[model samples]
Target: MDLYFLGTGAGLPSKRRNVTSIALRLHDERGTFWLIDCGEATQHKILSSPLSLSKLEHIFITHLHGDHIFGLPGLLGSRGFQAGEKPLVIYGPRGLEQFVETTIRLSETHLPYRLWVSVIDGGVIFDDEQMTVTCRQLNHGIPSYGYRFEEKPKRGKLRQTLLQEQGIPAGPIYGKLKEGHDVALDDGRVLRSADYLAPPTPGRVVTILGDTRPCDSAEELAEGADVLVHEATYAASEWERAQNHHHSTATDAARTAANAGVKQLVLTHVSARYDEEGEAKLLADAQAIFPATTLAHDHLIINVPRLPG
Candidate 1:
């Protein structure tokens, strides 16, 4: 999986960055991408990237803030114009359904595809064959949330050589064995699937948080995640302002990642006040606490690698 940052600025846009939008691409695993946040001009940002509206399968909103959801209506409307007929599901806090419904109703927008809005109250919001998503409310000005995407562990490869050596002809039995099912041979022999399979491949975990203050929920959502995407809306020295605004500083984000024991920390949703020099300070502050910290830029792509078997 790969995280494509379409926008990274906080509150508003700047020459260096747009607002907060990210695309979690699962093309290799699911042939689709899940959008996280739909900040202003998100569709415009997608135009510059390789992402397509047709391939957008899900959308997750962190909060009702304009910087996080202003572009949602436009994106949804344009998806129809682009001939995107795939059903799309949106998950977000309360009022999300009303917001989308109101906008669509007022605009008289007729979506050709089906859309479902799930008002989540934390816990496991999504579970499917390939992945499970959990959410936790965070200390934000509004009902902001952090999401944890945990991919399901994959079954091991079938031991074709072992089966061939046993004179077991390859056919439907191989599929069953690969699925970890014990099979009975025609000759009255029982073959344990465990003995004919390699170790399962561990799935990757990614946590993406909304704008929030340094809080326990943030750490909980990011615990042991392969990548923790947290907002660093200010430098360490502005902790007072960050706290007052319910936003995290660079140091605060890194500390949370360290406490959570995450493999890597990614800082985004930067305040537009930061220039190139100020941005460097944010990175420095985060790296001082957590060495594996990355300052995300607009259109940046970060790979979340699966664990080795």
Candidate 2:
């Protein structure tokens, strides 16, 4: 899986960054992508990136903040032209449904596809055969939330070499065995799939949080995640300011990652007040707490690979 950062700035847009928007590309897994948050002018950011609105499947909003949701109406309206009759689902905090309905109604925008908005209440919001998504409310001075995307464990690889050694040729039977099914051959030999397969591969966990201060709920949602995308709106030196604004500092984000045992931590939602040197200091602060930390910028893509079974 790959995380494409479209806008990594906080509160407002700047020369180096836009607002808060992230595209979790799942092309290899589901042939579609999901938006974590739709900040102001998010569609414009997507236009400059390698993303298409036609493939957008779901949108998850963190809060009702303008920077986190101002682009929702525009993106939804534009999707009707590019996505044809594709259905879209949006999940967010309370009042989201009303906001979407009001905006679409007031603008007199007609959509060609069906759109569904779900109010998030902190729990497993999505669960399918391939994955599950859980949410928890965070301390953002508002009704904000964080999401945990957990991929289901995949079946083990087929032991092609072992099958070949047993004089079995590749065919439809291979497909069944790969799916952990037992099959009987024409010669009346029963081949157990477990005997001809490797151990099941473990799925990956990705945690993406909305704007928030350092809180226990954030750490719980990020526990043992393979990739934790946490907001670092200030450097460690601005801890008081960060706390006052209900935002996390770089050190705060890193501390959560270290406590959660996440494999990697990505610090985003940067404040526009920082220059190149200040941004470097933010990275340094985070790295001092958690070594596997990455300071995100616009267009930065983080590739997360699966773990061995």
Candidate 3:
């Protein structure tokens, strides 16, 4: 799986970066894209990427902040105009339905496809055969949430060489072996699938947090994640300001990653004060606390491979 940062700035859009928005591309696995926090002008950001808005199947909003959800109405309307026939589901905190209904009513925007909105509390919001998504309440200025995306483990590959060595002809029986099924030959000899199958491959876990202060809930949600994407809205010198505004600094984000035992920490939602030349300081601050740390920028795509056991 991979994560595409459509916008990584904090508070508002700037010439170098846009507001908070991320697209979790799952096309190869599920043939759809999952969006997290659609900030202002998010659809415009997707236009610059290879992603198509029409393929967006799910949208998870963290809070009601303008910088986190101002682009929802426009994106929904544009998806219909762009020939999006598939159904779209949106999950968020309470009042999400009212917000979407009010915007569509006042603007008279018509959607071509069915729109499903779920305003839920902290729990598992979505689950299917392929993956599961869980949410927990976070400590923010408002009622915010953090999400954890866990992919289901898949069966191991069949040992073709072992089967060939046993004089077993390869055909539809290979599919059965891969599915962990035993086959019986005409001579009354039973061949067990476990004897010719490798161990199951582990799934990948990715955690994404919205605007919030450093809290235990964030750490719990990001426990042992392959990649943790947290908002670093300030520098280490602004610790007081970060606490007052319920935002996290680079050091705060790294500390959370270290506590959660995440393999890699991605610092996003950067403040506008830091220019291109000042980015190194941010990375250094985070790396000083946690060695596996990196700063995220606009249009930055991160490929998270499966973790080694």
Question: Which has the better lDDT: candidate 1, or candidate 3?
Answer: 1
Best by lDDT: 1
| Superposed Cα RMSD, model 1 | 1.1
Off by over 4 Å in 3: 307-309
Give the Cα error of residue 79 in candidate 2, in Å: 0.6
Model 2: weakest 10-residue lDDT segment is: 177-186
Q: For each candidate, give its TM-score against the true structure.
A: 0.97, 0.96, 0.96
Residue range 176-240, candidate 1, lDDT tens digits: 99988999877899999999999999989999999999999999999999999999999999999
Backbone clashes in model 2 = 0
> Where does candidate 3 have its weakest 10-residue lDDT segment?
300-309
lDDT of 3 by residue, 1-309 (tens): 799999999998999999999999998898888999999899999999999987798999988898999999999999998756789999999988999999998999999899999986888999998899999999999999999999988777799999899898899888888888998889998889898888777889999999999999999999999999999999999999999999999999999999999999999999999987677888899999999998998899999896533
C-alpha displacement of 15 in model 1, angstroms?
1.1
List the global CA lDDT of all models: 0.95, 0.94, 0.92
Measured with C-alpha atoms, the lDDT of residue 105 in candidate 1 is: 99
Please tell me which predicted candidate would have the highest TM-score against the true structure.
Answer: 1
lDDT of 3 at 308: 36
